[model samples]
Target: MPPAPQAYRPATALLDLGPTFWDPVEGANFPGTIVRYRNDRAAAEVGLADLDDAEWVRHFGRFAPLPDTLPQPLALRYHGHQFRSYNPDIGDGRGFTFAQLYDRAGRLMDLGTKGSGQTPYSRFGDGRLTLKGGVREILATEMLEALNVPTSRTLSLIETGEELVRGDEPSPTRSAVLVRLSHGHIRIGTFQRLAYEQDEDGMRALVGYVLRRLYGEESDDPIRLLDHVVRRTATLAARYMAAGFVHGVLNSDNINVTGESFDYGPWRFAPSWDPNFTAAYFDQTGLYAFGRQPEAIHWDVMQLAASLRLVAESEPLIETLQTFASHYQPAIADALLWRLGVVPRGAEPDRALVQTLERALRTTAAPLDRTFFDLFGGTVPASYDAAWDGLRAALADYRPRKPSDHPYWQGEPCAMLIDEVEAIWAPIADSDDWSRLHAKVDAIRQMGEALA
Candidate 1:
């Protein structure tokens, strides 16, 4: 086994950090399926293996001397408009980006905590994450990746020992820290919050800083800074659609300006081929539903553009916004072709193949796996085919009445039948059936490779 991380922060200080999200870690709890990890080993395995003394001290102010390296949410100072209102009170709550490290695959990743503790942004609420929230996030991320959506990965989930109250369901709930690894965690909401507060200079400096850090190619071009961000944001929104994942909470705060999938609360996999699946409990208007995802993305891009408009203009920003649909349509089309059994015959936009696939699915009311595997994925290579076959057989008697039931297939959103795909992902919520589901997942993966 690898050694634990030193209970100290690195001395090397990089970015000028800001306030915290919640007040403190009042409690903690997690599911048994969570993976326990030591960050020190993970860091050392990559080139960014060590932290300077100062770095550790500044980030991990309270939770020092940890058994393993947990990312200290580099307290980012950002403001956001929640539910269409400019709420200048937002930041990382529950937890923050504990650390940034390259993983075993040589991929750059951010170690993020779900309910590590509270920070400055925890205003009035307990900065605690629920047990179900953490579990759902893990399952959501895992399945999204298997479906080819760009997303954050769950690295470790440790129960911190405590409980708290909640208005949604029950009071005195379990608490835990769910650490997620992703490409980055910065968001457009981060910029909007600052700009909304007339922090023009702050927003500009942030834009320049982000370009250098992420979009390194456009760092020097001050005038085109917002333009670059707009393009990147637009591209990501389109891609999110290709994976059939609905980021229910597309609040300015949840929009990852870094292009990485940011927050994971209230997110739901689409139930069927429909794009109107809403994940949030009270999303009566379905602002962030399945059908509105693409449009929601543009609106978010517009918000980011508006934040930049502090230095630019609405018209120019709107012009830049046009690129979203262009990029998205083609990308989704290509993605759908791969998911469906047919290739782009260059005949009729492939709607026939899509319609056929959907019609067939509705006929048998089979699991998404069976529809895609038997039809699009085929029975070859065993894994994907077997997975679908297993899933269909297991859920042979199941039915879907709502849209948030299962992981939706991205291509041709409305062309298939959906009982809310709940049954396909049923195992994730139930530990008893996880083993069977995992085996099926492995098979699904094989089929995914063929599609790729």
Candidate 2:
């Protein structure tokens, strides 16, 4: 009655997919391999950890039963606007959804595999994803999550023993498939597919189904459904700006209608707050740039609103669409303030605060001493006073007689304060002095346990 505690589907799905979605990619049938296996404890909090190798491969890869597990293949239908042009043929071309499970903390999660193998949707190209794609996605997830952005979590990457040919990068390089967990895989294009075809009955069925599954209500009403999607989308854009992330491809297919950040292809963080920064290799026009993400999100939302117009009034829908600005600014400001360790001024827009906020991105100019912003709680060396002071000096209005006396980190007894972060994400290679940094991470974990 309360949504089955996780990403559980009706038993009817078992009967629906049958044996098709259960077929695994034989050998290196996929350009990539499923090698490494890892779990995310933080992601597990959202009921994701349970979809381990055994449960995941069978469902996602469409492999036959090796043991007790759920049979849910990864296949969905959707259409999208590619480079400002509408394209009707697009879906899970080379990936599949394996299983939805409860993580360690009991949150609903979907485990899906990319570059797994060929699917019904594979058009003309080889049904595979490149190793570099996996690496880029891993970095995207790490950087965004560290900044507290809502995004899909990259769980594991496998380097297939075999080599696959690709156009870009190097030939016969390596091959890999990534296992990522997310809140939902459904997208706006999913509904638009049928809606645009003038299939009114089909659109009604799809919208109603999505509402019951994703929005937690059984509503045939299009207004509530559209508004719910708009609200979630507004928060998503706000979070993106807050974390300085750019989803290089904000096409309708890539924009998750459920509002969960999905599809990590060609995503990048602002190296230094350059608005035009793009992560995609072929983004010639910079449609999905860092500064344009909010606009891009709205554009995608409008498309969804347009599709929903088949059943809903345009007047009320326009108001819903207009509310994006009302919600995004405050949320983005809060995120910026938190990242800079500045106390929030509250719900009203803080013009002075906005100007001061620019200093955080300017790490070199004013040199806010002892700067720091970790998604996790502070504890690592980056969380130390040295990091803090480096950040404060960057602000415009500040009068500090001594370099170390900046207000941001110049409070109270110096020795009494403690900053603890569970893990530091720097490379373990040499410069990290891996052994030493590891010990620090362990010590922080131990300290956290003791405090708990």
CA lDDT for candidate 2? 0.59
**Residue by residue across 255-358, what tens digits does model 2's lDDT show?**
88678787777665554566677868899888888778888888888888888887778998888888888777776766665554445554543444555445
Instruction: Estimate the TM-score for candidate 2.
Output: 0.73
Clashes of each: 45, 38
For model 2 the local lDDT of residue 154 reads: 76
For candidate 1, what is the lDDT?
Answer: 0.55
lDDT of 2 at 109: 56
Q: Rate the local accuracy (lDDT) of all candidates.
A: 0.55, 0.59
Candidate 1 lDDT over 269-367, as tens digits, reads 554546566778888888888767777777777778777778776776677667676666555555555554344554344444434444444444444
Error of 1 at 248 (Å): 1.7
Q: Estimated TM-score per prediction?
A: 0.70, 0.73
- Pick out the ten consecutive residues of candidate 1 with the lowest summed lDDT: 20-29
How accurate locally is residue 67 in candidate 1, as Cα lDDT from 0 to 100?
Answer: 32
